[model samples]
Target: MSEEVGRTAQSGWEVGVSRTLPYSGARLWEFLLGREGVEVWLGAGVELPRERGEAYETANGITGEIRSFHEGTRVRLTWRPKDWDHDSTLQLTVVGQGRRSTLKFHQEWLADAAERAEQRAYWKDVTERVAAALAER
Candidate 1:
């Protein structure tokens, strides 16, 4: 099935969201795994062993696909949540901006309007918390 196929037993679709963090790209990747990392961000529900192709999981039962991981630089994964039929593509990017860094996040997972709305709310909450965490450091 293509990426657009509906869930195994569903008739609806979902949407995705893009968010930006206050920190540079490198720190965002690191923060997802550091002690304060899990405590601050929404990704990395489960710890990634920092190896490509390792099976990672989230606390919410979302298994992850560590497609690309570069020590302290970047990561892209397939994030699966029990509530959705398809796993969204989650990507992280770190870039230098002036005197600071920018963390860019893109998530393409969900297949229903309602699900998209709910996921948006979920990310909004996480974004605020993550911003604070990055600010403190």
Candidate 2:
């Protein structure tokens, strides 16, 4: 697991978590953007369309709108939990070769130190689950 936390002059605090997976970039993209794939790894049903301004929500009630999308490459979206006062931004990027890929995930505009820590742990666990699910495939 590779993780970083930093303070940005304009964004307050940001958290990043990255992993290198033994899967092709396309495979990883499928796992992230495909309905069945997300349901298995994230443990929630998602309605995601790879288009700007498209809305998405998890079965558990997390909601967001797509900010940017590049097929098989990257996705940037607004992520807002039901209780959050403001939305945070999440970006997922993938780069890889024939059979391996590096996944970079970054979340910014956190509210405070406590929220930062909480998000760090949550993302860590989520990424671990994703990797495990990929391995099982």
Candidate 3:
């Protein structure tokens, strides 16, 4: 069988979504890592730790462990909702050039195409929420 659009030999099914905003990378990074923004994108009522191997669970019961974190640039973690049977890797990156910044969300290790599609929609919605919040600033 031919591999699907987001399927990879190493990571399995995956999805990625991004949004560019009219803010500097530094500004976007600050907001993305800030408490309010973190709750929006990451989860509600959880402060993501900077150290790798740190585990966290949101107020809503989604759990994850930080795999890597680069100050002001990116973070990688393993995420698993309470209902999920396995963990997936998620990476968020902020790329800034001049006055604009691009926020990227990538997830891999999805179970199948359905999971990939679901995550794609989920990330798109997340980007929209993030964008809307920034636009209000």
Candidate 4:
């Protein structure tokens, strides 16, 4: 059998979407954690705790816990929609060089290939929206 896309023995199913933005890592990091960017990336009403292991819930009914956070670099966390039976690991990363940076959204431990594809599309749309929003500023 052919190996499945985004499948791994350790992580099960996964998906990643990224976009290169014309911004610094520090700037993108701040925006991503800010209220407006939180709504764009995470969800509305999400106020992530500063400490690891702290739990959070969004207005749309998703729940998760913080795993780790690296200032101006990346954040790793657990993500679970209200209807999902299993939790997934999500990592947001920004790597900047010179005047541009690449923002990455990576999620793993999904239930199956279908969910992987679904999340892939979701993140792609999110990347586009984020790019547009940043361009306006």
Residue 115 displacement in candidate 4 (angstroms): 0.3
Best-performing candidate as measured by TM-score: 3
Per-residue lDDT of candidate 3, residues 9-121 (tens digit): 99999999998889999999999899989998889989999999999999988899999999989999999988999999999999998899999999999999998999999
* Candidate 3 lowest-lDDT run of ten: 1-10
Estimate the TM-score of every prediction. 0.67, 0.89, 0.97, 0.96
Give the per-residue lDDT digits (tens) of candidate 1, residues 68-96. Answer: 87665567777787665677766655565
TM-score of 2: 0.89
Pairs clashing within candidate 1: 13-111, 13-112, 14-110, 14-111, 14-112, 23-101, 24-101, 24-102, 25-94
For model 2, how does the per-residue alpha-carbon lDDT over 3-92 read when each residue is reduced to its tens digit?
A: 344767777888988888899999999887777666743337776767899998888778889999998998898888888999999888
Superposition error at 28 for model 3 (Å):
0.6
Ranking by TM-score: 3, 4, 2, 1
lDDT of the candidates, in the order given = 0.62, 0.82, 0.93, 0.90
lDDT of 2 at 64: 89
Off-target runs (Cα >4 Å) in candidate 4 are: none
lDDT of 4 by residue, 62-135 (tens): 89999999888889999999999999999999998768899999999999999999999999998887877777
For candidate 1, what is the lDDT? 0.62
TM-score of 1: 0.67
State residue 60's C-alpha deviation in candidate 2, in Å.
Answer: 1.0
Shift in Å, residue 125, candidate 1: 2.3
Displacement of the residue 7 alpha carbon in candidate 1, Å: 16
